[model samples]
Target: MNAEQALIAYVLRLADNALILGQRMIEVVAAGPELEEELANANFALDFIGQARMLYTCAGELEGQGRSEDDFAFMRDEREFQNLLLLEQPNGHFGDALVRQFLFESFYVHLLDGLTRCSAPGLAEIAARAIKEVKYHLRHHSQWLIRLGDGTELSHARVQASLDDAWQYTGEMFVADAVDTVVHESFAGPDLEAVAVLWRRDVAAVVEQATLALPGDQAMASGGKDGRHSEHFGFLLAEMQTMQRSFPGATW
Candidate 1:
């Protein structure tokens, strides 16, 4: 695809990741381990959803379409979403959720920092605004990762298992395709190869502090960038889009 199309697709990929993860977090709104943690979970969910709104709005502008962010979010089919397979994974437990957040945010923080300098004016502006929130997200998740991993033997074991399960999904984050190459090469987008280097360093530091071992490189699960997703995505989309599908254009 051309540069413009590639950029549009790139923005949607960002939006989908934030949106899906936000939905996953919101699933634990009233089920957090504690009251304060529940509040934090809700707040983090809003942060991601807010990010998604901005991204979807920008994608709509880039597409030169009349579609609103709601339409892009609520009216899309499961296969149409470009979110990473990692984000769509089920939130199994408290530790599972934290591990997922830490891994994704570690990479996301670097990705946004690079986007802030991209040639696209809109993307740079959005990245500039979003990176501040992402910094906190990384810190929050990273701290929890260290806590759970270094805490009790039980906590350590569970979190470590969660990390291992999530490790395979992490590979897709740095696998650049035509969409990534066109955007980075022509549109001054983030070099994902470089992002991968930073990701490894950041993740390794946390793993070391937590007394956890990094999993070996294994066969990577991919295809979310190309609108392919795991089995969980359909269930997520069904719940997320039910209202819009049931009542087309119905609004408060």
Candidate 2:
């Protein structure tokens, strides 16, 4: 596509990742294992949602089609979403959620850091503001991952399994496609290959600290960047979009 279209797509991809993960975390809002963690979970959920809002607003402006953030978020079909497959995967348990967040946040933080210096001023500004929050997010998840993976026998096994299951989905994060190439070449956006290297180092360090084994190399599942997703994505969209679909234009 053209430069503007590529930019819009790039922003939507980022927005979709945040929105989906934010929705997933909200599922555990009051169900966190403890009171302190419950509040922390809610706050983190809001952080992702807030980031989604900023990206969607930027995308809407770039598209200049009169679409709002709500429209992009609530009005889109399941197949139209461009979030990572890993983000849409079910948050099975406490460990499952933490592992998922840790993996994605590891990559996201670097992506935002690179975007902060991109040629696109609007995207660079958003990235600059977002990197701060993402840094905290990465820290939070990384610490929890270490705790769980190095905890009791059961905790260790569970988190290790979560990591392995989640590993397959991680491949998509770095597999740059045409959209990514255009965005990088035109807007000076993140180099996915470079980001992948940093992501792996961070992940390996945490896994080692947690006393967990690094997941073995295997066939990587992908296609999320192209609007293709895992089966779980449909259910996520059903719940996420129900209100707006039922109410049409109704608002608070």
Candidate 3:
């Protein structure tokens, strides 16, 4: 793809990641262990959804399409989405959700920081705004990882297992592709190699502090960014788009 096409795809990838994870979080808003936690989870979900809106809007503009954010979000088929496989995983449990967020945010925080200085002025501005919210997100999830990891024996074991299961999906975050290459070369966008280094160090430190065993490198799962998604994605997209599909052009 050319540089402009790659730039639009890159932004859409970011939006897809945020929107998918945010929708997953919405699934368990009422399932939080504590009321305070539930409220926090809801707010965090909104933060992600809010980020997705901005990104989708930016991408729509960049594409010079008449499509709105709702069009990009609600009109897309399952194969059209380009989120990471990690974000589409079921919210199996509280611990599962927590590990997923912690893992993704760890990498996302670094990514947005790089984008804040990218050559694309519009994306740089979005990244600057996003990184601020993501900083707090990282800290919140990091603290939860420590709490659950160093807590009771059962809690520790469960969350650790969650972390291990999620690790394989994490590999996709740093798998730089042609889209990444184009954006980076043209816009000084994020270098996934550099992002990977920071990701490992930060994640390792958190694991150590949580008294959890760092998972071994294992076979990685990818392809979500290229429109190949996990089995759960179709179901997720259907549910999320139900209202829009059932009632076209409906709005709040």
Model 1, runs deviating above 4 Å: none
TM-score of every model versus the real structure: 0.98, 0.98, 0.98
Shift of residue 34 alpha carbon in model 1, Å: 1.2
Of 2 and 3, the candidate ranking higher by lDDT: 3
Report how far residue 86 has shifted in candidate 1, in Å. Answer: 0.4
User: How much lDDT does each candidate structure score?
Assistant: 0.93, 0.92, 0.94
**Per-model root-mean-square deviation over C-alphas:** 0.7, 0.8, 0.8
Local accuracy of candidate 3 as per-residue lDDT tens digits, 173-227: 9989999999999999999999999999999999999999999989999999899
Clashes of each: 0, 0, 0
Could you give candidate 2's per-residue lDDT for residues 1-252 as a string of tens digits?
Answer: 898898999999999999999999998787889999899889999999999999999999999999999999999998889999999999899998899999999999999998998997488998988889889988988999999888999999999999999999999999998889999999889999999999999999999999999999999998888888888899989999999999998799
lDDT of 3 at 133: 89
Off by over 4 Å in 2: none
